[model samples]
Target: MAADDIAGLIREAIPDAVVEITDLAGDGDHYAAKVISESFRGLSRVRQHQAVYAALGGRMGGVLHALQLTTAVPT
Candidate 1:
């Protein structure tokens, strides 16, 4: 999938999130994403990552091969 598609999915889940998606390998299968949202403020790192993965709705191991994900609360 495309970077924009990934970003869109995250945005849809977290309306106020700032999502930046990078195509790490330039192959469209490897990606790096930085997600910032107020909703993540009190969540554990694993939970934050889970929220993101949930946004993808099972696309992670399927259509999306690899994703380097970093999530944080808005500064």
Candidate 2:
């Protein structure tokens, strides 16, 4: 799970998304992602996170270990 791959997945799912992924532990397994998109405008915080998770296509607990996620509607 490279940072670019994570970003790509998010972008694929949310075409207008701006995704930033950080390699937290300097390891491919741990990450922190900030996803911004207009698509999240009316969604709840939990739903916003879920959307991002869904974009990963079930890679969350498998190939990717831990992700600290932050999502927002673009300002």
| TM-scores for every candidate against the unseen true structure | 0.98, 0.97
Over 3-63, each residue of candidate 2 has an lDDT whose tens digit, in order, gives 9999999999999999988898997999999999999999999999999999999998999
TM-score, structure 1 vs. true: 0.98
Writing each residue's lDDT as its tens digit, candidate 1 over 1-75 gives 999999999999999999999999999999999999999999999999999999999998899999999999987
In model 1, what is the error at residue 14, expressed in angstroms? 0.6
Winning model by lDDT: 1
Check candidate 2 and list the clashing pairs. none
Which candidate wins on TM-score?
1
Candidate 2: list runs displaced more than 4 Å.
none
- Residue 57 miss distance in model 1 (angstroms): 0.2
Model 1, position 9: C-alpha lDDT score: 96
lDDT score, candidate 2:
0.94
